[model samples]
Target: MPRLMAFDYGTKRIGIAVTDPLQIIATGLETVHPKDVIDYVKKYLLAEPVERFVVGEPKQMDGTESQSAQHVRGFVTLLKKNFPAIPVDMADERFTSKMASAAMLAGGLKKSDRKNKALVDTVSAVIILQTYMETRKF
Candidate 1:
């Protein structure tokens, strides 16, 4: 079965997550440099069947689009232009980074480890995917 992929987009890096083939669990896949994300997804597609994409929709506390959202939408446009078959959706991403940090602390990560942006990105992607999944019917 095809799986769903999620991305937490940032200016410098993008965190990725993918569901199991059964679509039962979402797992953190990797953190890729912004420039390398397209190539990375291309390579990943060779091994996994991805049916759809879930991108974090950056929003401010005031319910306005965040400045970074433009960059994310740009990425989504490029993604659609490259892979016209797959559908893309966006999920609210407010507080995901803070949630990731709290999760890391609860997971007993060391102070140094908790400070790793890459790790936070990956965890944030997982949270996004999981939240998206929770809203789905299946």
Candidate 2:
């Protein structure tokens, strides 16, 4: 069975997450540099079967597109071009970072550990994936 992948895109770093083959649980995967994301995805795809890409879509509180939206759109275009067979979708990413931070704190992470942006990114991706999954009937 194939899995669904999610990405929390940033200017400098990208957070990644993927569901199990059963598509029931989402797990934090990795964080890659912006320039290395495509290569990272390619390498990951070689090992795992990914059926779809769910990218975090940044939006303002007013429901307007955020500045980072353009970058995500560009990345989506690149993903479509590079992996035409796989479908790409966007999940609203409002407040995921904040939610991730709270999760880390609730999980008893230390200040130093919570300060790791990469970890936060990964958790954010997982949150995005989980949120997206909730909307699907399956």
Candidate 3:
């Protein structure tokens, strides 16, 4: 069975996560630079078959598009063009960062470790993936 992949996208870094073949749990895969994201995913696809893609969609408190949404949308467009066969969907990513932080703290990471943005991004991607699986708001 093909796994499901999720991304927590940023201008600088793109956090990636994937589920097992059973799609039971999401695991942080890697945090890659934006310039290398597509190629990185392609490389990963060579090893693992991914059936679906989930992206964390940024939104404002009032349910409007956040400034980051435009950038994410651009990435999404490129993603769809590159892999039209796989379906892509978005989940509301309002408090994922905060949740990631809390998760890191609860997970007993050191202060310096918790400050790592890459780890935070990866955790956020995991959170996004979990949210997608639970609610599937798309």
> How does model 2 fare in lDDT?
0.96
lDDT of each: 0.95, 0.96, 0.94
Write candidate 1's Cα lDDT for 1-138 as tens digits: 999999999998899999999888999999999999999999999999999999999999998999998899999998999889999999999999999999999999999999999999999999999999999775
TM-score of 2: 0.97
Model 2: per-residue Cα lDDT over 35-60, one tens digit each: 99999999999999999999999999
| Top-lDDT candidate index | 2
RMSD of 1: 0.8
Candidate 1 positional error at 129, Å:
0.3
Q: List CA RMSD, all candidates.
A: 0.8, 0.8, 1.4
* Residue 121 in model 2: lDDT: 98
User: Candidate 3 on 1-105: residue-level lDDT in tens?
Assistant: 899999999999999999989888999999999999999999999999999999999999999999999999999998999999999999888999999999999
lDDT of 3: 0.94
